[model samples]
Target chain A: MPSIDVCYSPELLHLYELEGKAVVAVDILRATSTMVTAFAHGATDIIPVMQLEECRAYAEQGCLTAAERNGIKAEGFDLGNSPFAYMNGQVKDRTVAITTTNGTRAIRMSEAAQEIIVGAFLNLEAVAQHLRELQLDVLVVCAGWKGKFNLEDTLYAGALAERLQGEFEFENDATLASLYLYHAAKDDMVTFLRQSSHVRRLENLEIHKDIEFCLQHDTYNVLPVWKRDRLVNLKEFESLGV
Target chain B: MPSIDVCYSPELLHLYELEGKAVVAVDILRATSTMVTAFAHGATDIIPVMQLEECRAYAEQGCLTAAERNGIKAEGFDLGNSPFAYMNGQVKDRTVAITTTNGTRAIRMSEAAQEIIVGAFLNLEAVAQHLRELQLDVLVVCAGWKGKFNLEDTLYAGALAERLQGEFEFENDATLASLYLYHAAKDDMVTFLRQSSHVRRLENLEIHKDIEFCLQHDTYNVLPVWKRDRLVNLKEFESLGV
Candidate 1:
């Protein structure tokens, strides 16, 4: 069986040897959710930029730009790191370049993995189904708040583990513990996550609605993959066998 | 009321200003548990050095040294970072310098805090009693796996939050989530942590027994504190009235 491991926070990325593993990048608070929503709304490809300047420079190339710092929309960007913004209109065939605090950094780091898949509670079933089909050793990379582990990401990792139980073997106790947390909180995710550190920080910015929207399961079937210095759909990579 | 904040992972340390908070560093995996055992066995003080070289230099000062890497004891150190090595006869009345991957890094980073307390499952009650005697805002620093969030530390943080309820205000959702996890696992801590990532990592090294020993509550009452580049007893700082 393929070994399933949990990177409880992005900082643990260095400790993992992602030689042949398929990495699932999870930033449940917003980034992955926004990307999934963007893909769902028919955006041709969502380019994840790690730095704001890079995103701005990419936008200068005529792509729609989205940027955020500390939860608020940046003044010059086309949108913020909000899923609601991604779903605001039909974006079919449009190209978007986006930047945020944590998620983009995770996508950038997983460039060396054999394959990378963006994960979020918003598309839980699709992610689970994809993992089951991939049948490769999996690594759930939680994009914690600025290089640290946060609750929502790890909980989602546990939920994924629970869903993929028979298909993979648990590589560590952290993964199992997360599975337990997911079981206990899956019934009431909203209440369970209401007081989380990320939620509290975002709430200080008056963005509780983003948390609610991010936790909605299977809202999008689109799977975002990192390819050619950008995050594109899996279909785009299939042609290249990446 | 004092603000009781639960930092789910050591990487989240940056989010905290630590300007006027008492940080309780909990690493249930081994560091805090071993620290408690060190004190209980009559060790004079533990200098929590982040580098292995520092521990070796401390040995040159005529103090015994202990080093742990990836949950295993370093070959040349006097002891490994295991609670079993810190029992009644092994560490009594001796000064020791220690280094580990995660726990020591947290102690060093938290030196700027108004106060830093080493917390573990072994000394949960003592920590609670100490909290009751004080009135400073408490920041529960979960020394996650290599600066990431791990379930055990958060669970311990939550347990402390539940014990300190009504005396302090919950600062975020991590605190509430940790508290819930602690309650959920209260009946079977060993079983709860058996499948944990850290535990599984240790088990791979044939140290699974350490995990069970580390999770026992109220096994000791000695609280470790950071003082003058070392983690000594909190009483040492009492003279400074801090």
Candidate 2:
């Protein structure tokens, strides 16, 4: 049986052995959520870069660019980390290059994994079902705020752990802790997450809608998976009998 | 009002600013518990060193030495990390030097704090009362297992957060998460912690008595605080009227 573990921050990723494991990089407040949303709305692929300049440079190659720093969209970028920006056919049939504070760093750091999947509450069940089929050891990497632990990503990890329970074994305490947290917050996540520091920080920035949208469960049946240089929808890819 | 934050592992301590904070270093699976027990049993002072050689070197200067690695006592040391070793007047009125895998490293890393205090369930409320009096921003550093997060230390952080709820504002999501974990585990810590990887690891090593003893709350009124070079019982120091 495969085991499920959670790395609370990208800073602590060095402590984990990522080889031959599937790494689910989640930043529920917006990054991975945005990636899943983009895939759901017919975006071709996404190149997740770590720097604003790298994201901007992709625009020369006709790829749509998105960048967020400290919860605000970087000036001159076509879109921010908000999922709403990826909607209404804005990114239809287009490639995108993106960067964000925490999410992109986590995905980039997880390059050592056998497979890297972008996970979020939007496609929670889709990711879980896909993992069940893969039967690989899963490590949920929560893209914490500024290299420290954050609540939103951890809750998403817990929800995933709960979904994969029974078939998956938890080898570490983090998975157990996350499952307990998910149980405590599942009934009323909005109220529960209102106490979170990042939620309050996002509220202060007036991105209340993004927070609400990102917390919604199973809104999309997409799986944004890394393939060499970009994230493409794995669920969509599989449905086409590829 | 002063705020409470939790650094889940000493490896992630660099993310926190410790200059003006009072750091409570907790290693509940045994290191901090043993230090509190030694102080409660009338030991004079404890010098927490990082290496076994450093701890062993103190014996030449008439100090008792205790060292543990990977949950087992290092060979030729006078004591292991078990609190039971300090009982029955064994370490009475004697200065001791100690080293362990996680706990002493956490104490040494927290040297930048205004004060560093050793905490465990054995001295839980005593440490809480001391924090309330000091009224400074507190960072509870969980001396996690080998720079990775563990359940026992995190549960201790949650227990401490729950005890200091109203007076101390939580500035981070880690504290809130810990408080919830504590609430979920407080009723039957033994059962709750049985799911923990470290507890299972310790149980495999046959230290059941140490686990049961460390989980008992407020067993001692002692506060083992770091002065310049050693940990001395602050409660005893205050009673001396110095």
Candidate 3:
């Protein structure tokens, strides 16, 4: 049986060998949630850049740019790290280049993975189904806040692990811990996460709506997968049967 | 109020600011447990060295040496990483020089902390009471398996956090997550930890007794603290009124 492991922070990514395994980069506070929302709203592809300048440069190539730093929209970027900004035709038929505090860095660091996909509570089932179809060893890499463990991303990893249960062998203590945390928070994640430092930080910024929106289960049926240079909707790609 | 945080692995210790805080280094699957037991058995002090050679060098100074690598006692060492090895007059009134794969390294890495103390289920309340008395910010450093997250140590951290609740603020998600894990495992830690990777590794070596012994709560009324170059029992030192 293929093994499932959870790496609580991207800074610890080097500990795991990523060769031939599927890596799911999760930043549920908003980056991956926003990316999944963008694809559901007709975004063509997403280029995850590490710097604000890199994201802004994509605007020259006719790609919609999203940049966030410390949970706020960066100066001169078209969008911040909010899923609401990706809806209602703002991202229709367009490509997106994005940069955020934690999420984009996780995707950039997972360059050695066999396949890298974005994961969020918004598209949890979609990511799980794709992994099941791929049938490979899976590693859920949480984009923890500032290279430290965060509650939201870990709960998302647990939710994913719970979905992939029985099919994947959780061989590490981190995965077991995550599954426990997921079960503890699954019934009322918003209330359970109210004590989280990151949640408090976001609440101080008055992005409570984003927190509630991002925590909703299976709101989007999209799997944004890494292909060559950018993330394209894998579900749509597979539907074309190419 | 001071804060309580959990650093799940020593490899991520750099992310935390340990300057004025009390760091409780916990390795529940036996290193810290052994140290606490040694102090309880009348050991004068413990010098935790990084290398086996360093620990072995202490033997020439008439100090007892204990070393373990990959869960086995190193050759020629007077003791392995087992609490039972310290009982029955083995460590009485003697200084111990110890090295371990995870625990000793965690103590060494936390050099920046204002005070470093050994924590295990064996000395849970003793360590917690010492922290309450010290009135300092606490960082529970789990000496996880090879710098990766492990279950038993995090559960120990959660147990400590639960005891210190209402006095210390849990400002990080790691602490919150650990508290949840502790609540999940508090009823029957032995059964809950059967799936832990390190527990399984030790069980393979037939150290099932060590696992059960290390998981017992408040077995020792001792707190081994770092003072100058070695760990001495803080409860005894405080009784001297020094």
Candidate 1 residue pairs in clash (backbone atoms < 3 Å): A173-B195, A173-B196, A173-B197, A174-B196, A174-B197, A195-B173, A196-B173, B42-B93, B158-B179
- Report the C-alpha lDDT of model 3 over B1-242, residue by residue, as the tens digit: 98899999998999999999999999988899889888888899999999989889999999999999999999999999977787878788899999999999899999899999999988888888889899999999999998899999999989999999999999789999999999999999999999988899899999998888889888878889899899999765221110
In candidate 3 the C-alpha lDDT for residue A102 amounts to 96
Q: Could you give the interface RMSD of each candidate, to one decimal?
A: 3.3, 1.0, 0.8
Model 3, A148-176: lDDT tens digits are 99999999989999999999999699999
Q: Which ten residues in a row have the lowest lDDT in candidate 2 chain A?
A: A233-242
**DockQ of every candidate structure:** 0.41, 0.81, 0.82
Query: What range of 10 consecutive residues in model 1 chain A has the weakest lDDT sum?
Result: A233-242
List candidate 3 segments past 4 Å from native: A237-242, B237-242
Q: How good is the docking of model 3, as DockQ?
A: 0.82
Show where candidate 1 strays beyond 4 Å.
A51-53, A56-60, A200-211, A235-242, B6-15, B50-91, B100-102, B146-149, B201-210, B234-242
Error of 2 at A42 (Å): 0.7
Q: What is the TM-score of chain A in candidate 3?
A: 0.96
What does the lDDT come to for candidate 3? 0.90
lDDT, candidate 1, residue B229? Answer: 70
Q: Candidate 1 - CAPRI tier?
A: acceptable
Residue pairs with backbone atoms closer than 3 Å in model 2 (clashes): none
Candidate order, TM-score descending? 2, 3, 1
